[model samples]
Target chain A: MRSEEYLQKYHGVTKFLRILAQISFWLVVVLGAASLALGVATLFMSSDSFTFNFLDNIRLSMDGVLQFDLSLANITATTKKEIITTILFALSSFAIIYGLIISQLTSFLKTVENGMPFASANVKRLNMIGILFIVGSFIINTVYGLVANKIIHALGISTLSVNLQSDANMLFMGIIIIILAGIFRYGSYLQDEYDATI
Target chain B: MAIILRLDRMLADRKMQQNDLAEKVGISVVNLSNIKTGKVKAIRFSTLDAICRELKCQPGDILEYQAE
Candidate 1:
């Protein structure tokens, strides 16, 4: 199909994606706020044995490094507090990064909806998201792993062998996005050429 | 770019304004201005043909090359 036809066909798709991104952005905001409230609430509660069921569901166990004893009955207050702190850290970071990602996606889709998909704005947004993925993935996982190890030591589980692996999927996805941004940059260059040409 | 546009000189030689050339060549004055100022990365063959026809000049008259 011709360029105009292709754009016409996908214009609806971009619009739909923009709407989805907007919804996801707000959801992230609301959920992130709730998590912050919950974390703060737990801090004031004067009990270590008192573990939230939802917190229990969000497991951050590494392979043989740190294992969460899901049986909240057996967990010490210090261990529980440490785990909660770690989870809050991870989740807050995720919400922030994810919020940024969704916002960038919304902006990109808006550009596409306006028939400027190859504009430099979209390229920059993609690059920003790509960098966020790469850096955030490494920092969050490594920090979580380290904090978990500290918890293991605190609990004196010296017998459990520690093995922490970086999230390969997110790293790969970040690399792919950066590559795509490069391609979009080239497309933007061509667009400039086309537009400037008489 | 190595390929330089001499459209400004050609327009001068023809004593023609950008508006006249753009109207005659069926292109916007902005595009003709870009060509005259060497702001465009390339000229499409159809546009080159149109410009040439309107200017009554050869493509070589509007285009030149110089090593940087």
Candidate 2:
């Protein structure tokens, strides 16, 4: 309340939202990746192996949630179906993770725009974002390794072996962010004490 | 916590309403109430000056130090 006048006059919430919107616009890349994956799956995969049970499970879940009828069963190709299925699975997993990250960021930014960056809600958001990033990167890495191995086998490329490795950079960054969230929570507690004191 | 506000007592002795004193002191009623209820961590000198001037009392008459 003491700095309300300065905050209201200089801190434009709309401006921040605009910038966030611009950045979030790049999320279109996820859609592009999904489309590209779908195309590649159609080109390389045989019809039988392309609709693996796991892939069908994913499709069925997605269909139930999104109410969309994806007709992947119509393809008559007989080669590289497993590879295609793996690629599509990886892409879909990445898209979901990216969506979660974006949603968390949007909510966190809104709280910041409200001029309470150290609020408990923002702290929780930060923690959630951090955990999501960590878990997401791990999942992506595992999926990528699986897809790579599947593709190698499909292509009869026996010389290469896929190794499972976590994204170290994302893991480290997530840990730092989680620590920052904890610090922010402490700051929020202090802010609450200060606000209540007066 | 050791510092207690005697604002309610002072207001009674001066026969002044909280609303009237808040207006005279140029602060919101909520702020004045916070001060009266000893909820404020600190008071600005300007606000204290205005309150003392309006209430026709010294600072000592409004604030008292008590051991916790």
Candidate 3:
């Protein structure tokens, strides 16, 4: 059948989900950049010199060499912990909000797959919600950075050495976030194409 | 939510069997039954056009709006 033959309205929820998905995509972009910058900066020094930069600065207490004779192994252990924590923080926040949006989107998509036409406004609303999430993530990152700096000064670690181990981990996470965001955005585009074909 | 499909009405007025209508429209008997019973969540334009053309009726004739 010709695509133009279908004249039903777009579902409200489906549109909202698309927009939300796109917004998260952008959030990943901004967060990725900030994470990379901070991570790279920290790699130049030890936790003592790193000072508080965010909630992560609290981890400075873990500084100091391990008993392991292999220097590489010791450093690897510490770095692994920091990387895991950073990724967990990012993934958890996104998961919570995205989960809600995804549920709604899935419901809407099912209806659409059945050949129902939804209202145009509903699609626009979904788009707006996604954008809001993207903006919210950026704001959160900024707040985290500000708080981290204040805490570092309060702890008198401002003049200390940079935490090379933690910084390396952060840098890796930043790169990952950016890449994930791109992949997600691409997914959305594919969804649109799929819908159109249908 | 209270909109009623007048498919049965059309079928009766045209004195056509459900099976014959389904075959003529190139749709399955199950789907035709769903439409007749208002169990369908949606109707594609192509499907609507096919039914209308076959039955010699308009969409308005088969769709009725009723307040909930």
Candidate 4:
């Protein structure tokens, strides 16, 4: 296919990804709120009733008092901590995945902006998507961090004590990718405009 | 960054209006305007070939590249 047609096809796919990213973003927000609520409720619940487990690292051991045909409430404090860590890790993982997706989208937007020649409407919308990804991703990630901190504080835990074990390098890479995408998008727009006059 | 489109210059030099060229080439004036203004990011090889034949000019007469 010709370059223009190929770009048009690419735009279609990117638009789909944009929609998916938006859905995932909202999901993260909702999940973050739910997790915070749980953390707050956990603070009010009695320690004896507390139960949690992590994957393969710790075993669930309940208080040996209530032993009337019980098979569920068998988790220890260590297990609970591990479980919380796991949940935090999952949230961070989702954030990372979404970040990478937005990074790639921004890159593609830049490529389109670079004088590949598209409908003005298409070009405008693509730029808008790029802006949305950059701004929305940052907002969502920031909110996630803040909410996690709030939950930790509400549970009488030091927020800084809990660290999600995502690679900092990867996060940095995602940010860089996004920044480059924005730059490219802007450059492409200017080029497209100048080319018009030529 | 310095890619140059000379299609407009060529058309001007030939004293040919874009509409006339579009008519001669059997294409819409909108498409021809896209080429001249570089609004269209790309032109199909067939379209380029037609434009060249109609204008009696080479692709080089229409496009030039300069470094950013």
Question: Largest lDDT belongs to which candidate?
Answer: 1
Per-residue alpha-carbon lDDT of candidate 4 for residues A47-149, written as tens digits (9 for 90 to 100): 5444443232433222234232322224455444534554555455555545545544554444454535343444444454445555555554554454455
Chain A accuracy of model 2 expressed as TM-score = 0.67
Query: Model 2 - which docking category?
Result: acceptable
Interface RMSD of each: 1.2, 3.1, 7.1, 6.6
Quick one: best TM-score, which candidate?
1
Q: Write one digit per residue (lDDT tens) for candidate 3, span A69-112.
A: 21122233345335434544544454544455554455445545
lDDT of candidate 1 over A12-103, digit per residue (tens):
99899899999999999887777777777767777645655544434446544755653443556666776666666656667887888899
Worst 10 residues of 1 chain B by lDDT: B34-43
> Candidate 3 at A141: error in angstroms?
3.3
Candidate 3 local accuracy as lDDT?
0.56
Query: How do all the candidates rank in terms of DockQ, highest first?
Result: 1, 2, 4, 3
State every prediction's TM-score relative to the real structure.
0.72, 0.68, 0.32, 0.38
Clashes of each: 0, 7, 21, 3
Please give the lDDT score at residue A29 for candidate 4.
Answer: 61
By DockQ, is 1 or 2 better?
A: 1
Taking all chains together, the TM-score of candidate 1 against the true structure is 0.72
Query: Per-candidate RMSD vs. true structure?
Result: 4.6, 8.9, 13.9, 10.7
Task: Give a tens-digit lDDT track for model 2, residues A26-56.
Answer: 6645664775678575765446544444333
Which runs of model 3 end up more than 4 angstroms from their true locations?
A1-139, A150-198, B1-6, B13-15, B28-68
Mark the regions of model 4 whose C-alpha exceeds 4 Å error after superposition: A1-3, A51-168, A175-179, A182-186, A195-198, B1-68
